[model samples]
Target: MFRYLILIMILSITLAGCTEQVKVDMQGAGETIPTGSTGIAFDGKDLLVAKEGLIAFIDNIDTATAGSIYGYEGHFYFDRYPITITSKENKPYITGLAWQNTAGNTGFIWASDEANRRILKISPQGDVITRIPLTKIYPEDITFDGEYLWVVDSKRKKIFKLSTEDGSIVSEYLSPVPVPTALAWDGKNLIVGGLKNLNNPAPSPDNVQIIKLDPVSGNVMENVETSRYLTSPAGMVWINGKLWISDRNSGKIVIISDKGEPSTDIRSYKLPAVAPVLKKVEAKEDKNKTAQDVDEAKRAAEEARKAAEEAKKAAEAAKKAFELQQKK
Candidate 1:
């Protein structure tokens, strides 16, 4: 009976090890993008980026608190070159990308082609599943909201919700900003970049913040300040209740928090006040100084009086000499 129980425990331990694959950072040692990578999507722990001329995936990365795209080492890349668009072969300008995690590693990715005016359904193995054409839509960034896809066009200032099956329009609404560069769905609200209010007479880019919108009513929920380091955000994703934004200018990904600065209890802070004992000491010092000043004043008055008497005697002697000279 003891041998049978030992054999069962050994088998269970062996099976558990076989079920999980060990994650190694070296698996993605060569999967890198040179500066122009924009469109970003995640597949479990892996990351997909639209490299300038191709789409690259970096495996075994945790971007939840990761700093930047270049901060990771090692990459295992599979490239799809000269992506076909509008029945023509060219280097596609892929702007926004969304990934739907499906069975095993057989999920699909949706990419917004800005220059070609279309959206593409692609397989993880770089296969083109389908393409949906767009009319007068200059798509900037895209995000997945359950069964629908949300595409933001900064030029048209419109957000479109589309069907994932055939990319048909489901609904549309006005964007909260004049130009929204990127969009992400944080479970409940749609987070968009570029928060300058052009409606105001003087608009500034320093007003750039994270703008949250209601997914259904298209209403502005709130606009929260982001770190000054974030500039020219291209794509964003929400994970672990924090927003991760990809910045184009810095070529890095940053975690953003909507909760502003923490409050402090200023009422508990008291200014240092002078004590009554110190005030009395200062008053005594002043009184002694005043006495010294009076002594100095009396000495100055005596000196002045002596000098005036000497001058009067000299003037009387001069007047008598002038009278003697007139008699001579």
Candidate 2:
């Protein structure tokens, strides 16, 4: 009986060695602000941006918590933003950021380390909870649809649905777009951004498109031409009833309204919040006021003209009444 038990224990040990368990690094690493941001995610209240080698969280898009992690500074469109960063030993290139509720209310930020070929689960407070290695595929953009996490494997030409518990692949299929760059969930459908045509040297701005697809079957439901002027879109998110996309080359974020026809109501960021140091003119009244003032002046002029017309009609009526009395 003892000999039989020893043989069974040896067999179990051999099986365990065959499969590698994911290493959960609780210590985390040193923090460094990324040189550039590539992806963005919103966690109801805060906005998380994925930089090349770091993940930054902006508490309310306007303000951030101050500390070591949040003290790291970075420039967005020439303006300085107080950004919180995620730490890693040898900062691997990160491309995507997605909010997941794997740990209940605390929440977790899912990041795709493209260079290292792995996915990292980080706490909202900048702690690296765990990492799942993707040995073969290169992940670009990632999106979470309530239950499962989906990743765009750019190099493999595939989109994969991964288990949140362990970054194990649940299912994967060929992407409808040849070179998919951005992914977003719009309540019911998965919206993907890709190049319309392969321009040999580089993709043309006019050929950029955002395609809506069935999350399960990956069928093209709608193809919306984004803009004839936008550079290849990098990150996309549905926020405040509009689709916000970032251009890869220009590093500018553009807002597109959800119109039935291909969106023409597109707006691009003109400049950063704070002007450059040398160009720090006065407090500078709101640029929006100029447009508003023109509209207000036009409205006042219109009202004055209407009043004058009404007054002229009243005088004419009085004059006609006087004439009728004289005739009587």
Number of the top TM-score candidate: 1
Per-residue lDDT of 1-328 in model 1, one digit per residue for the tens? Answer: 9999999999999987652332223221222243546777776665667644366665444332234455444323332332333337655788888888776767888898887778888887677888888885787788997678989887777787887776666677776666687788877878877646545454343756567777655556676667665656677766666665666765556567754332221221112333424343557889999999999999999999999999999999999999999999
How many steric clashes between backbone atoms does each model show?
Answer: 6, 0
lDDT tens digits, residues 1-328, model 2? 9999999999999987653322211111211122235787777765566667655555422212223364533222212232344345555777777887654577878888787778888777677788888865688888888888778866776777787787777666666667788887777777778665655466577667777776554456666657543557677777766666666755545556543343332232111233325765555476677778999999999999999999999999999999999999
lDDT of 2: 0.65
Summed over model 1, clashes come to 6
For lDDT, the strongest prediction is: 1
In model 1, how large is the Cα lDDT of residue 293?
100
- The global C-alpha lDDT for each of the candidates, from Candidate 1 onward, is 0.66, 0.65
Worst 10 residues of 2 by lDDT: 24-33
lDDT of 1 at 266: 21
Model 1 score (lDDT): 0.66
